[model samples]
Target: MEYNTERTTLKIPEYGRNVQRMVDYCLTIEDAEHRNKVAQSIIDVIGNLNPAIRDAPDYSHKLWDHLFIMSDFKLDVDSPYPIPTAESFVGLPDEVPYPQKSRKFRHYGGVVKTMVKHAIEMEDGEEKEALIYGIAYAMKRNYLKFNKDTVSDSTILTDLDEMSEGKFKTEGIDLPHSKSFNIAPAERNTTAVRKKGNNNNSKKKKRRY
Candidate 1:
């Protein structure tokens, strides 16, 4: 028995050695008409190997291309579609550019940075102060959530000051303590819902009589 190691390497291994041998036999056919007919038959055989390709728009075109590729582009047969050349292949895709804008603090997120920038441009008034306080409070909450540890109000103030480029001062304003935010309302709501469901199920167990 002839082993693959001893045999010449197939151009396209997916077509198999038998298909490759058929392709080799196809190249040796003297008559152009007979070669074309044999080539079409060979395409039908390979095309059946992958019935999924029939759904494609250029199904026959792809099959002819595969035929040329299997024959090492030496098969002189009439093709309906444009025959591909080595030079026709486009190289690797273009590189995508990295984002220019980046957040000052990733944990605090981009929204906080935007708020800080907006606050810096705002007029000195009551509305701006409220927005500033809200931003700071949100920052602390995000920091706690990400780190899963309690943070001091001063740390939040210092971070807010540094991130805003010392434009926003946290001197007079006092941030709310982390203790209040420990128990999230969402968790409480979920627990309440589960308890209510259990009560309903227990009630359902009692007869309508």
Candidate 2:
């Protein structure tokens, strides 16, 4: 008697190294609840690390490809499609005007501005006034330049002190005045000192003769 034989083959989907690692890690978790929580946490971490990934253009394409391979040509699920929204037909709205391009910079600036405003309103004194003046001074001088070498904070502070003097002036705020603020006289004296030293050297040569 002859027996009929039949054989079947299985095809496995190939995943990228990173995706394979993630899949292996997920499979290692025994409990379904814990596995889901871990997976969500991982997704959240990735989103935080690369915010651009959240609104990526090619994400749907990549997802559909992965789904197709995973289904092994058996599942009849439709390919992923872009969700229709009121804004989808229209282009993205213009970004709000802000000094710095970085979100972190804007966040920190907002916090500083709020705290300084509160301090100015609640307190009444030279120190408070100076603090407010300083804040305004900083805001006026604050700028972001790409591709430039990093400058020392001290040098930036000095530049701010010079440039923001009249620009940040506010009504009813009196900054402490210093008596020794003569730039021209100081420069003239420095020049005179050098001249006198040179004359002294000339007199020594005459005496040697």
Candidate 3:
């Protein structure tokens, strides 16, 4: 009996062993025209074996690339797409550069820092003040949500000043109270209170009856 160890290794296992054998046979064909015809047929079989392969952008190009890969790039068949080199599959991709700007407070995130930078650039006016207030309020709300602790208004003000290079201030601004941090919790409390009130009324009505 032919065991898996005795057989040739599959180049792309997704296409299965039979497809790999077909690719191997394709490389042996002397005539380029006949080899191209067999290659196309093999690609059709590959598409049937894995329908989701068509989901890729430039799917026909990708399929042709796979055909070449399965044949170990030995098949001299006419291809619709640029024939990928062995190095294309083997070589490492270029390194992606990381952002140079560092976050002052990671909890508030990079977006908040960007907002603060923009706020600093804006001319001092009513619009700037409104923006500063909104930023501060948002920071405090976010801080409370993440930390699950009461973050003092002063902390949010301090972070804003540091992030904005001491440009923003909370001296005259009326920021939302700590209770504003969790609207859902406040809503839940209100619901519980109303439910208690209804239960109490029901008990009183039962006593009267």
Candidate 4:
């Protein structure tokens, strides 16, 4: 799918260089099994890097975030389809760190909003599939999700397997996972009081007989 015209392109030359490095590294691996493993890792790395461009405090620039997300999405490995390149990096302002307090910030927000709009416009298939994979990978690795407990390699592998099968579902949006429904002490106390009130009323009615 074509990216929104308003979103700015990223200025990171190292991103392309890193992709090339990954491609080269993948080519060097001899065994097909090992190569596939490395390829998956590279894909995971790219996926992780994409969201960081937008979410990271350091790379708060909208153009940079949009470019990174698109470039990573366009990168094709082992596909017969042609992969998009840095030359495709278009629609960005020539200046860096766009005037922070200027009207341009509104334009940048519009660009991001448009990108999301286009994402929803995309039909269910390869484009949606790639996005799901990218998002799932990011969620798994993000510190917020696993702050107290570290996610195991086996768990990642299991999720990867589910992803391959197209059964890997996200909570709330795609699939609804069972969430804890704990009753607060105050709520429990309130229920107890209500029950006691009903019991007292019953006792009063019986005494009237």
Candidate 5:
């Protein structure tokens, strides 16, 4: 039995050693026409091995590219599609730059921070006050999302003050209504509904008697 340790390293192991062996055999064939036919056959086998991708657009082209890759681009075959280089497979993906400024409140996220910054820069007026109120409401909503437990208006105000670097003041700002965040009403309503249902069933039983 031939162990993988003794065998040559596979370029794309997903295709398996048999597919690799077929690609190696294609490289040995001197006739371009014969090699192309063999490469096509190997691609068909590869498609069968991975049936899911076979239905994808340009999958045949991808299979042909894989055939070249498996042979380390040594296989001299007439391909319908562009022959891919070893660098194409081994090339590093483009670097994605991360945000330089970290969010003070990750729960509120970058949008809330941006809103706070814009509000801080704005001239003191009804519009700025309105924007500040909007930001506060958004922050409160975000806090509730993070914690189902009701968040205090003071907590949101403190966060807004700290995030604005003391540029914004909450001294005159009346804490927004906390009714939306309060889950007690919902629980109370549920209890009331259950009690009403029981009373209705008792009334029906009395009517039946």
Candidate 6:
């Protein structure tokens, strides 16, 4: 038996050893026409093996890229799309940028801070005043949600002012009562539990005989 440890390593292991071997064989064919036919066949096999990519927008193009990748960019068959170089895909996916802005009041969450910022930028008017109050209410709600203990409306307003660099003047804004944001626990099925208990009792009595 030819152990995997003894054989050459596969470039893309998802296609398995047989597929890798087929790709290696295609590299040896001298006739350009025959080699292209065999390359297309290999791509077809790969596409069928991974049915998930069949519905993708550039499915065929992706398959051709994978074929060249598996062959280590040595496959010279005419490609339907632009030939991809090893360097183009060297780094793989780009890194996603993380939010660097630090929040002192993390308990109120980031959304509250974002709202406060937007409220600060708006032109001062009745509309801006409503938004300022809305942000304070949200801050208070978020504070109550995060911390089990109740937070005063003043504290929420103070936090809003601090986050917005005193831009949002919520000195007299009153937030809704803490009870408004209280998350109620899910109720148990008491009736079903009682029925289940009675059924168990009846089953026990019958089983005793």
TM-score of each: 0.41, 0.20, 0.41, 0.25, 0.41, 0.42
lDDT values for all models = 0.67, 0.37, 0.64, 0.40, 0.64, 0.64
Error of 2 at 156 (Å): 38
**Of candidates 2 and 1, the better by TM-score:** 1
Local accuracy of candidate 5 as per-residue lDDT tens digits, 1-209: 23324558777766544456557767887877666766665665565555566567877787777778778787777788877787777652222122223634766755456556656766786546656776687678556545545667788888888888888757776665656545344444554566578669987785221
Better of 1 and 6 by TM-score: 6
Model 6 lDDT per residue over 1-209, tens place: 23324557766666654457568878988889878866876775566555565677877887887788778888888888988889868753222122223536865654455456555766777656755776676677556545556778877776777788887767678777877764332111333355468669987785331
Tens-place lDDT digits, model 1, residues 12-118: 66555445766787899898987886677567666655456678787787778778877877898888888776555454212212212353476675546655776
TM-score of 5: 0.41
Model 1, position 90, has a per-residue lDDT of 50
Between candidates 4 and 6, which one is better according to TM-score?
6
Order of all candidates by lDDT, from best down to worst? 1, 6, 5, 3, 4, 2
lDDT of 4: 0.40
Q: List the residue pairs that clash in candidate 3.
A: none
Off by over 4 Å in 4: 1-118, 144-146, 151-209
Worst 10 residues of 2 by lDDT: 1-10
Give residue 116's error in model 3 in angstroms.
64
Candidate 4 on 1-209: residue-level lDDT in tens?
A: 11223324433433333333444555666777655544554444443345534454543344333333434544334432334455665664233222122232121222222222333444566444544444433334331121334444345435444434544333333322212212233543554566578669987785321
Residue pairs in collision within model 1: none
After superposing candidate 5 on the true structure, give the runs of residues whose Cα lies further than 4 Å from its correct spot: 1-3, 91-209
For model 2, what is the error of residue 129's alpha carbon versus the real structure, in angstroms, after optimal superposition? 49
Query: In terms of TM-score, which candidate is stronger, 3 or 6?
Result: 6
| Local accuracy of candidate 3 as per-residue lDDT tens digits, 1-209 | 23334557767664544456567777887877767766776665555444454576776776777788877777787888778788788742222122223534755644455456656766776546755775687677557545535767788888787778787766976677777544355444454566578669988885331
